[model samples]
Target: GAGVSQSPRYKVAKRGQDVALRCDPISGHVSLFWYQQALGQGPEFLTYFQNEAQLDKSGLPSDRFFAERPEGSVSTLKIQRTQQEDSAVYLCASSKTTGPGYTFGSGTRLTVV
Candidate 1:
């Protein structure tokens, strides 16, 4: 893909349910990041992966939030036991390296009821 692609543009999950959001970044991008965006605020970093190694997951709000990039290209952000507070837009971004700006995906909006 020419740009970052995220699946299931929107998702509605019942409370306690689980959801997985997928992101396919540009070819050869070595750095991938996941962020959470509330209704009106800027996106907050959740996790980052360099190649297949998860370098930082400190921003993830809880243990229920997990992110992975198994092959260093496509990534998935999974939320376990969804909660109402988890309703937000999950954004995925990728860059060639740490020195350059990233290309962001359209995002997957998750609503927990």
Candidate 2:
């Protein structure tokens, strides 16, 4: 892909339902990141993966949030049990290296009812 691609541009999840968001980063990019953006707030870092290795995940809010880049290109962020507080836009960004030149995806907007 020419840029990062995200699936399910909009999602409406009933409370407690599981949701899986996909992100396809640009080919050859080694750093992939996931961020959560609530209404009116900046994107909050959730996790980062470098070539299938999860380098940092301390920013993930809870255990219910899981992200994996199995082959270092395509990634998935899964929320086990959706909640009202979970309603937000999930953003994915990729870069050739750490700390800059990041290209972000449009993101998946999730609404938990």
Candidate 3:
């Protein structure tokens, strides 16, 4: 892809339901990441993967959240038993290095009701 792509730019899930968001990062990028952004708040890192290796997942709010990048290109984030507090924008970003800038997708706005 020419740029990162995230599906279902908007999602509405009833409480206790599960939701899976998808991301397609820039072609050939080595590093991919997921972040959660609550209303009026900055994005917080959720997980990071480097070429199919999940290097970090310390920021995931709970075990209910999971992310994977099997082929090191496209990724998915699954959240189980969604709650109202789970409403937020799920952002995906990819970078060649851990360094400065990162290209981010528009994000999937998940709204739990």
Best candidate (score: lDDT): 2
lDDT of 1 by residue, 1-113 (tens): 89999999999999999999999999999999999999999999999999999999999999999888888889999999999999999999999988549999999999999
- Local error of candidate 2 at 7, Å? 0.4
The residue-by-residue lDDT of candidate 2 on 22-58, one tens digit each, is: 9999999999999999999999999999999999999
Candidate 1, RMSD to the unseen true structure: 0.7
For model 1, the stretches where C-alpha displacement exceeds 4 angstroms are: none
Question: Model 3 over residues 1-113: C-alpha lDDT tens digits?
Answer: 78899998999999999999999999888889999999999999999999899999999999999999988889999999999999999999999777548899999999998
- Tell me the deviation in Å of residue 58 in model 3: 0.3
Clashing pairs in 2: none
lDDT comparing candidate 1 with the true structure: 0.94
lDDT of each: 0.94, 0.95, 0.94
- What 10-residue stretch in candidate 3 is worst by lDDT? 93-102
| Prediction-by-prediction clash tally | 0, 0, 0
- Of 2 and 3, the candidate ahead on TM-score is 2
